[model samples]
Target: MSKKFLDDAYNLNSSQETQDLYQDWAASYDDEVAENGYATPRRVAAALWAHLPEPQTPILDYGCGTGLSGLALHETGFRALDGMDPTPKMLEGAQAKGVYRNLKGFDIDDPAPLQNGAYSVIAAIGVIGTGAAPPETFDLLMKALPKSGILAFSFNDHTLDDPAFTSRLTDWVDTGAARILFRESGPHLPRQNLNSDVILLEKA
Candidate 1:
């Protein structure tokens, strides 16, 4: 009944810390998050589906931990899915789900880990939060996309409260780099009373 990792997930200070934490938590990550009623993955999947209904669109689930997000996308009818995570242990869990067409592990510090225009759609659900990916990660994800590509991501209440996180999003839209296609605030983890904003952005 230990919830150490979940409790400290949002307080991570560095990429190393985040990686180390997930390496250990990967095995129980799904069950632990489920107990809290994790909802961002489904919410993000449905929002992306609304904008791009094509079942064959290629999708990159960045920071896809344990394949829950991949499952949601698959259930929503996306046939092509590629998952990438910095933590190999988590990637192993994701691989076991048999949802993704391709899966790989990359160093979180790599300046441009994603291939440009490789995926028409990218998802970063439950990433880019207080103790997860930093604000700059948003720019990296967006830059990897081709013009007209879509990026669907979420910012939990903790991330929303910090302008550093919210500002990165505004900077993109304000600069005409990307346009907000869909944004809705809803449950992230119901049991934790947490809420998150699921957003879809298309490169201009």
Candidate 2:
């Protein structure tokens, strides 16, 4: 068995460190998270589907580590899915799932890799927060959406406790840039006693 990395997931201090950690953890990510009862992906996918409710609508699963999020989206009836991640090893796992129409890998330092308005609905499930993508990533995804576009994502208990993370969500809503369509807190990794907030935002 591989050494467990989930315990150190939130302690990563840099983008390179984060990428390297996923590279090593990619193979066992699904199994380990499943063992811990990972639930955010399903919850986020359902929330997004409830608002969009269009299976054919194209979705970009940004930071789609290992395609678990993509699988959840597919299970919710979404078919036109594209995924992007910074870790190639993680992308390999995602590719094996065969759910995304396209999967791409990007440089972690590439601040604006996504073409603006390319996806009507972009998901960042488990992408942002303490040890993952930074707060500015929320801005990047929001900027990539066209008017009335949707962004569905999650913030785990660790992230929700940080003002830096929650403030980004509020900044967009408070500034009239986006509107909250759905926000619910529920199980994330039930076995670990973790919880997360599944949030959906429509670009205004």
Candidate 3:
């Protein structure tokens, strides 16, 4: 990725201005992404659910823009869905779907608001790069789960090959903090000029 992308990705929590930018973008996000066919959220959600612990697992859809992942999760038989995002407009879009039990403004860098051991699965689809949360946030979220808690998330396809992020992810898997359940590379969305690698990480 370019330096700008990495900077935006790693510096998501650096200020309030960036947060506002996302809020502004949320309103037209669906229309903007529609051009790309919105393939990522569905693909990632499906891969994640396939490796989940159980059907009734309570899932936290981290950065769940417009409830895309939440809707997909529900269709896959996941119940007890909750959504969190920094943008109220984004949450508004998600709330309209009525699939989430709870929706709140969440800063991924500060996950203290989320209860510890309260989720069996956490999915942060399209929430790990450029103008989003950093990769370390995944570690924090996973730590919130109990042993054997399932974590299914995706990184932009471009980031999957980045050395810094890849190394960190590999470390987690190599150390047994998490196990790789599934990984797939495919078009996430064509309009957003994005692709992603959906990876399911299960906490051990």
- Winner on lDDT between 1 and 2 is 2
- Highest-scoring model, TM-score: 2
Give candidate 3 misplaced runs (Cα > 4 Å). 1-17, 53-55, 107-111, 191-193
- Candidate 2 residues lying further than 4 Å off, grouped into runs, are none
Clashes of 1: 0
TM-score of each: 0.97, 0.98, 0.85
**Model 2: clashing residue pairs?**
none
What's the CA error at residue 119 for candidate 3, in Å?
Answer: 0.4
Order of candidate numbers by lDDT, starting with the best:
2, 1, 3
Clashes of each: 0, 0, 3
Instruction: Please report the candidate that would top lDDT against the real structure.
Output: 2
Residue-pair clash count for candidate 2:
0
Clashing residue pairs in candidate 1, if any? none
159-182 per-residue lDDT for model 1 (tens digits): 999998899899989999899999
